[model samples]
Target: MGLRWAVREPQLGDVRSLVEAELACFEDPWPPPFFISEILAEGRFNRVLVEPAGALVAYLFCAWQFLDLHVLKVAALPVRRRQGLGRTLMELAERHARESGGESLTLEVRPGNLAAIALYEGLGYDRVGRRPRYYANGDDAVIMTKRISG
Candidate 1:
């Protein structure tokens, strides 16, 4: 194996660590059962970025429906922020979605999350819509979408 990190489907053992990372990344982290239901229960497509030593550095969860992959959440360890982990996770999900017959990716990010918005924008995601008071604190959500194929 090369020095590259491994990004793959998340296993059961990743729930707690992934939740911790999510908590660090969001003010209102998702509950444990949410992860279990979406990822481990086969209801959704989930992937993680793990270091060579088996540490989960990042993750992305998507609700795959028809040809659309709705990104529920993507997060990396707080200490690992700004290191392109989020982008790497996005790329992995995009590749997986394409291989799985998905034609587009969509997500809703809080308007206040400038970093995440910038990341998505840089990756070709554009604002397609908005949801009023979509966040826990009543912040608007900027809905973004990227079409991966014609």
Candidate 2:
């Protein structure tokens, strides 16, 4: 079988699976109810990339307002990391944001996450600012933004 993946709005049923994937990738994963709340909230966007067998392999969450798309979270399963899944999910978000008249997509990543910095940089995101003590352990966050003109 060949690899296949697609991004779609996350379902309530996928929260547990997404949390599992998040746990695999992060030392601090959001609780299941948090994902549920995002999915149920207005002006928020949450999507998941399902594998060939319908497993949740990756997820991206963002909050939209006016011309801004603020990416709140994203993660891929350990087995899917470095396999282009994250890039694909981000591209999907960019396309959606542009189509929705978003002027820019913004995100903050932990300063120590070199892999994520490289991924965002490679995808045309520039480091625009920083937030000190942004992460749970007081790690600084490198703010990045990619303009996707409407």
Candidate 3:
């Protein structure tokens, strides 16, 4: 049987597993304290998808800044990729942003991440700008934004 996944706000107890998932998903993962701070931040929205057994498989971190919802990170474990979990997290983030009176959602992604770019574009995010040599390895970052409608 396939695993059942549930998406919900992450709790303090989920930090270890969330960090583990982040490490598995990203080349340069955020430190555990970053996740902790985001979860505790007042204007931030953090969600995680977990299996029935309580193993965190994916997570999304975003924050409200003025009229924008900034997507700081979103990732799914390698074994759980391409299952629409990232899209699901994005939808949740959008809903939260709209509810909080955000006018747009924006994110920065590595220019070479075609799959992520396609996903963001498919979800209505347009390339608005770029940051030269944004990553530690000197890769340019593409800035994308999607306007939110009430």
Candidate 4:
């Protein structure tokens, strides 16, 4: 892990690269407008991990729902996968959420995405339920949640 990096909110100017990250990580990618809306939403955000040169390393888009933080999307570039970038971003998200009055962190992952499942589990999240036909490809989404207690 590197000693220093930057995690900041995605801006309108970064939509193109954010969309590219979405395309690289997901088969059903979100469009530019969706990113725009989230970027403008109060308390909702698209956070990015960037290199010194400002290239995207990984990103996490989260939605604020009541007292919970829902992870809408998260991904590291294919070449950057498994380098703890995702974990670092997640840790930062958790701390910020906790400070922002969030009681829990929640997310949905495709049932077939074992790596993501493992990562969430390792982060103290537990399977809470499942949503059938959640994805465009008809994959079930495994819902996971972790209560935040300090």
Indicate which candidate wins on TM-score. Answer: 4
lDDT of 3 by residue, 14-103 (tens): 888888887787788889898888888898888898889888888899888888999999888888889888888898889888888889
lDDT of each: 0.86, 0.87, 0.88, 0.87
Which regions in candidate 4 have their CA more than 4 angstroms from the true location?
Answer: 1-4
> Estimated TM-score per prediction?
0.91, 0.93, 0.93, 0.94
Q: Which pairs clash (backbone N, Cα, C closer than 3 Å) in model 2?
A: none
Among residues 3 or more apart in sequence or in different chains, the pairs in candidate 3 whose N, CA or C atoms overlap within 3 Å are none
Worst 10 residues of 1 by lDDT: 1-10
- What's the lDDT for candidate 3? 0.88
The predictions' CA RMSDs to the true structure, in order, are: 1.8, 1.9, 2.2, 1.5
**For residues 1-150, what per-residue lDDT tens digits would candidate 2 score against the true structure?**
135886689988888888788789888789988988999999987888887789888889999967889999888888878888888878878988988888999999998899999999999999999999988988889999998773
Model 2 residue 63 lDDT score: 93
- TM-score of predicted model 1? 0.91
Comparing 1 and 3 by TM-score, which wins? 3
Better of 2 and 4 by TM-score: 4
Candidate 4 lDDT over 1-150, as tens digits, reads 474468788899999998998899889899999999999988785688888888987888898898899998888999898889888878887888888878999999998888888889889999999999999989989999999964
